[model samples]
Structures are given as C-alpha cells and as structure tokens.
Target: MLHVIVVLAGLCTMGMAMPLPDFYSYSPEAGGGTGVMYSTAHEGHITGIRIWEYASAYIGGIQLRYDGNWTDLVCVNSGTPMEMLLVEDEFIVQVSGKHDSGYIFELMFVTNHGRSFKVGQPSGTSFHLFPTHDGSELRFLSGRHNGWGITSIAAHWAVYSSDNSVTP
Candidate 1:
C-alpha cells in the first residue's frame, strides 16, 4: 500500500509539470516567399491568437483550415482593430476606422454558409483573406499607415502527436 501511494503521487507530479502550448511568430521572408503562418491539418485546434501592429495598413483576410477544407476569413477596412476573438472555428473582430467605425466582422469555418459573414460598416473595399503556403505563411495587404499591418501573430494550439511538430 505504501509503494502504490508513492507511485501515484509521482505520476500526479509528472502530469502537473506538462507545459502549455508555446508561442510562435511568422514574418515575411527576406525576398518574399510562400509559407503558411500556421498549420494543424490533422493536428489540433488553434485556441487563441494575438496580432501585433507591424505597420499601419488594411487587414485583408485570414486563411483558415477546418476539418480538411480551407476558407478565407475576411473583414472590412472600416476601422482599426479594437479587439479580436476566435470562437470555435471562427475568427471574429471589431474595428473602428475613418470610414466606418465601431463595426464587427467574422469568418466562419464554412464559406458563405450563413449571413454572408459581413457586418460592421459597409464600404467599397473589404479586407481579403490570404492563403497559407506550406503551413508557414502569414498574409497581409501592402501599405503604410499608422495603426495597421500585422507585425506578428502569436497562436495557442495543441499538437495531436509529438512526432510531427515544429516550434520557434
């Protein structure tokens, strides 16, 4: 009985020491290249994310993969990013800009499945979602402003297996 109790306590300690997901960053290649910002094809779920301000520019779109299909989650350039959220498999955001301020936008796992996924202020130009190349691409529009451009993207996700994985 004493030996079993000691072993059980040791197991509990080991489990408690497991580390959470690590942070990752994706930047443009030196000479412009193709890569996906992040990928978990058959791996795991992206629980949360943070977008840093690289430069002032319009946030075009986000290319996300669910199940096995990919979809472009886009938004309007109506405003700057006030806050961001990733619910389930959807990327939702709130923006306030010169044209349309205090608006909301979202991209679902499925394309055009419901509500057109358009909200907030309407404008002639809306953000376009970019695609991921080889699970190392982070897409964005080109321009310089003051409070636009995504400098860095940090994501929190899990790995299905330890065999196939990359960390930075």
Candidate 2:
C-alpha cells in the first residue's frame, strides 16, 4: 500500500508538469469568410445576403448584432467580411480572403451564460450551407457519402424538457 501511494504521488507530479495543448496559429488564411447566418438587431431583423463588393467590402467586419444599437455593428479588422443569414438571431461573417480559400465561414453562439459555441466547417471537403428559422440549426448540402442529401439538422441536442421549468 505504501509503494502504491508513492507511485500515485509520482504520477500526480508528472501530470502537473505537462505543457499546454497545441493551438492553431492565427493565420490570415486559417481565418476568413462570413458564414450563412440570421440575426436580430436594434435596427430590425437583417436577412438575405449575396457575395461582396467594394460598396460593402473590406470593412474589417460585416453584419453583426448587439444588445444596444446598430452603430455597435462596427467593423474592426482590415478587410471585408462575407455576410449571410443563418437564423433569426444569428449572423454569419468571414474575413474576405484573396484566394476563395483565404477566408472561411465560422459560426458562433453567445448563450445567456456568456459561453461561446462555435460552429465550423464540416469534415467533408465540399458542401453547401443555407439558413434556418432560428440560426441555431444549419441546413446543409453535402456528399459525405457517395450521394449526399439535404438536412436541416446535423446532430441532436435537447435543451428543454416537458417539465415546464426554466431552471437548469
């Protein structure tokens, strides 16, 4: 028992001495593109989007909503962001890239808890994405297998039950 305790102590010491996990380098290439999104804002509900032009391009950031006003939708980067609607409350934007590959579409959700949930590219190389009613779900076109189909949902998640309680 004493020897086992000593070995456990050694293991714990070793575990406490590890380096951090490798992180993705912030590359202009690794991050770009606006995703398909839908968002609610003080101005109203913003929907529908196409590609980009100088009239709406290279503004650093694209369409986004805030708890306050429309002026808060300011861009801060150095390029235009692709814009799209994902749901009623979520807007998708990406940094415009040179190569179409330079930019990527990523989705993030800021829940009531202040936690951010990011929705990103599918593992499959090629596919298309559309919007949903609430922005929490994604409608996609993929050929993950030989012949892909359309699905509004990629996975399943349950947030509430029939108990009629708001308590988590």
Candidate 3:
C-alpha cells in the first residue's frame, strides 16, 4: 500500500512539471462550395505568412512559414501577394477576416508585438479569432479551398515553449 501511494504521488508531480498545450476552438468557417480539406502541420513557431488576394475579389492563396521553412501554398497563386515576417520572440496572436457565401474576402493577422498584417478587400461577414488562454498563440490552420481561392478557413492555437517546441 505504501509503494502504491508513492508511485501515485510521483506520477502527479511528473504531470505538473510539464505543461500541456491548449487547443482553442476553431473559428466559424466562412464561405461556400466543397473543396479539398487541408491542415497545416505544426512543426515550429510560425515566423511568417504570405497571402495572395484578388484586387477586388476574394483571397486567392495562403502560405505559412514555420521557423525558416515555408509550407506549400494552399491555393492557386493568381492574385497580388503580400507577406509578413516576424522577428524573434514574436508570434501571431489573432486572426480576423471577412468572408461571403462564395469566398474569403479579407484577412488580418495580429502579432504579439502589436504588429499586424491586413489583406484583401472588405466586403462580407467578419470573423475574429484568438486563443482562449493567455500565452497561447496561433499554431496552425485548417480548412477547405477551391482551385481558385480559399472557400473556408479556420485557425488553431496552442502554447509553445521558448524554442518553438510544443510544451510537453
């Protein structure tokens, strides 16, 4: 009985030593049409973002940079491209956008350093996304996209260590 109690106590302490990552609920997906679903793999801290937006239409494409590696573009690249690179210790904390029934119209990514990246024309319902817990940040993204543009979008959030690794 004493041995069992000691083992249980050790397990509890071990769990407390390592903080778990928190996953905030995804934002409401905007737009219409069926398309292939995609989810960005969480590797390291998101250091940059590139967005392709039609001049007066919808968002055309998007890409994320983890550490120094860039993810594949999620949609066709036929629009004006805008990019934002983060400095060290900076992270995306919020994502706000506008979308109609057909496509995502606009997007804005806000960083912890008070910097922001805004793109596309504003003409549709608006959505603002952020993590629920303090210290958590934008970790990844998932949604569907048609051949020409992003039809729907969502954001993922989690707490990461200083080295950009997920907290154990």
Candidate 4:
C-alpha cells in the first residue's frame, strides 16, 4: 500500500508540473454542409491576426501570424480588412461572435491588455469562447470555412511552455 501511494503521489506531481491545453467546444456551425476544415497548429506563439469582413454582412476571411510567419488566409478576402498586432506577452483571452443559418456575422477578439479587434455585422446567434484555465491564452484556431465565410469555428488555449512550445 505504501508503494502504491508513492507511485500515485509521483504521478500527481508530474501532472502538476506540466500544463495542459484547455479545449473549449466548437461554436455552432451556421452554414449547412461540412465546409473545408482548417487548423492553425503551428510551432510559434500567435503574434497577430487579420480579419476580412463585409460591412453589415459576414466574416469573409481570417489570417493569423505566428511569431513572424503568417498563415494562409482562410476563405476569401472580399471586404474590409482589419489587423491586430500583439506586443510581447500580449495574448487573446476571449472570442465572441454571432452567426446565423448561413454565415458568421460578427467576430470580436479580446486580449489580455484590454484591447480588442471587432468586425462584421451584429446579427444572429451569439457565441463567446474563452479558456477555463487561468494563464491560458488563445494558442490557435480550428474550423470549417466555406468559400465565402466561416461556417464554424473553435479556439484552442494553452499556457505556453517556457520555450514557446504549446503545452499539451
């Protein structure tokens, strides 16, 4: 029994030493049919984001900058574009949006520094995404985007390890 207790304690300590990613559920897929799936799972920390949106319409496209490299834009760039750059240690803490049966109408990214990037129109069902674990920030994004707009979306959060590796 003592040996088993020691093993369990060791396991608990190991678990505490390594942080894990907190995965929130995906938001509702507003558009019908499965669109092309994309994931921004790269090796560096997120340093910026670009969003393209049609005024009073929907989110048309999105791009993320990881460290110094930018991911390929998902969907089409058919509207006004906005960009947000993060300073060192800044991170996204929340993602709220609105979507309807046909498109994601709005998106807003809130950061730890109290800054936010908001776009698109405000019409449809609402969604708010955030990490449940403290110190975790937006690490990446995964979702399906139709050729026109984002049909579904999800955020991945993690407390980045000291070497900038995503934990878990």
Candidate 5:
C-alpha cells in the first residue's frame, strides 16, 4: 500500500508539471462585411473568446452557429452586460457591449472538480463550417446595426475527443 501511494503521488505531480496548450492567438481582419461567419479547423471545448470592437457605441452582439442554424447569443441593444443562455442543451456564454467592445480576457473553462483550462483558437482565420458540422462557429457583427466593426477575434478552446469528457 505504501508503494502504491508513492506511485500515485508521482503520477499526480507529473500531470501538474505539464502545461496546457495555447488555444487563441491574435488574428486581425479588415474590410470584411457584417454577419460574416467563421469556423475553426479543429474541434475542441470552447473555453472563451476575445474581441476588439472598432466602434464602441455602435458595437452589436454576436451570432453563434451551433448544431445547425445560427442563434443570436446576445445583442448589445438588449441592455445587458452578460447573459447565459441554453441552446440545444448546451450553455453559451454571451457578453454584452455598448460604448465598449466588452473585451473578455482569458475566459477559462471550469471542470466539475473546479479545475480550469484555458481554451484554444481555431486552426486558421478562413476555416469553413457546414451545417452538419458538430463543431461550434462564431459569427462576428460587422457593418451591422449602425455599422459596428469587429477589429479582431480570438477563440480559446481545448481539443475535443470522443474519449474526453467534460462537465456540463
């Protein structure tokens, strides 16, 4: 029993020594129209998202693509700072904005055990997504509702695998 305890202790230390991968990276886009949809190259649990809005007051909300169709996560016009909505059995984290871009810095995905992981971004900027695709996609508000422009977008997530399990 003493030997087993020692082994387990070593294993736990090894896991702690390893570090999580960087999910999101700074990517800039310009001259894009509003309501432009973007997809990730890989599938993973979305931890958080970061945005840079050009116009503060004119900034609009975001449209998320989950399951099949697009769903409005949040609209700044609603007059709310943040909202958690249930979509197709999955919970979406929506942040509101008004005269500010409402920057979200390092949104972490918490586990059932209270452990948190930093999410990663998609493979590239131009990745496409189909309706049948199981992965989540983000549609930025550009030139919409007073011509609010998204200066930059970064998605944080972890690699999704069938064997991998997560808390709801």
Candidate 6:
C-alpha cells in the first residue's frame, strides 16, 4: 500500500509540472497545431468598426483603426468626420476637408486595396463604408455640424448602438 501511495504521489507531481491543455485541447505534439490567438480577419468582410477619410481624391480613402487613427489618417486635411449608418455590412464615414487645396489623402489599405482616387472632391462627397484589414480596434472621423446642430439626431440614428438599437 505504501508503494502504491508513493507512485500516486509521483504521478500527481509530474502532472502538476506539465502544462495543462487549453480550450482547443492543445498539445504541442498534437500535429495539427495550437492555432493562433486571433483569427486573421478576412479583408473583404467588414465587421466591427471602419472609417474612411477623403482627400482631393488623391489622398483617396483612409480606413481608420486596424484601419488607422484619425491623426495618422487624415492628418493634413483637418476634415470633419461624421459616422454614417452601417448598410449591408459596412460602417460608412463622411469626411469633409477644410483646407482649400493641399491634398494629403491616404488611399485605403496598402496591401490589396489601394491606388488613387478622384481629386478635389471631398467637400460635399460621402465616401463608402470603410473596410477592416486587421482584427483590432477601429476608428473613423465624423462631422457633426448638423447643418444647424440638427444632423446630430440623424447621425445618432444612423450608427448602431451597443444595445443593438438605432441611436436616437
């Protein structure tokens, strides 16, 4: 009985030393692999958040957050970014520039979605919903001038609230 007890204790100690498996029943030698912490977001599928700023058509559309930050995105333009409703799987942003004409627009995604855009057309143009290339935080610029502080209500209604209701 003493020998059996000793063996049991030894087994328990060894088990304690070994790392436990994770949610995936992970084992380094399992062959298939432990997989990654965050799945690579499919570039085409635009979920979460997205922002795009326009610049003379030359700056094109800058997608914020994993897309990019406003400071880094439309830095030179100093435009107003307004959050538009998410239609069909995208978060739209309307960025209007204040500068007379000094284009510094950044074309959307460098990898597979960038080139150039229409020049000098950002003042009253509404760009499309920005796409997310990575799986991190997302940001977009907004213009809340509201034509008379009235567009605020419309802007709220356009965005999807955390509770899943259209914001009022």
Tens-place lDDT digits, model 6, residues 72-148: 33222334443322334344232222222233222122112222122233333232322222211122233212111
**Would you give me the overall lDDT of model 2?**
0.27
Model 2 ranges with Cα > 4 A deviation: 1-52, 55-60, 66-68, 76-167
Candidate 1 Cα outliers beyond 4 Å, as residue runs: 1-84, 87-119, 132-164
lDDT of 3 by residue, 42-129 (tens): 5677899999988788998999999899999998888678999999999999999888867889999999999999999888998888
Candidate order (TM-score) = 3, 4, 5, 1, 2, 6
Q: What is candidate 5's lDDT per residue for 40-92, written digit by digit as tens?
A: 33223333332222232322344443334444443333323332223332322
Off by over 4 Å in 5: 1-19, 22-59, 65-149, 166-168
Each model's backbone clash number: 16, 16, 0, 0, 7, 13
TM-score, structure 4 vs. true: 0.79
lDDT top scorer: 3
- Candidate 4 residue spans exceeding 4 A from truth: 1-33, 166-168
User: Stretches of candidate 6 above 4 Å error?
Assistant: 1-44, 47-61, 65-74, 88-168
lDDT for 132 (candidate 6): 26
Ranking by lDDT: 3, 4, 5, 1, 2, 6
Q: Between candidates 2 and 3, name the one with more favorable lDDT.
A: 3
For 66-168, candidate 4 gives per-residue lDDT tens digits of 8889998888888778999999989899889888876778889999999999888888888898877766788778888878888877887777666665455
TM-score list, all predictions: 0.23, 0.21, 0.83, 0.79, 0.23, 0.19
Runs of candidate 3 exceeding 4 Å displacement: 1-25
**Residue 55's lDDT in candidate 4:** 69
Task: Give the least accurate 10-residue stretch of model 3, judged by summed lDDT.
Answer: 17-26
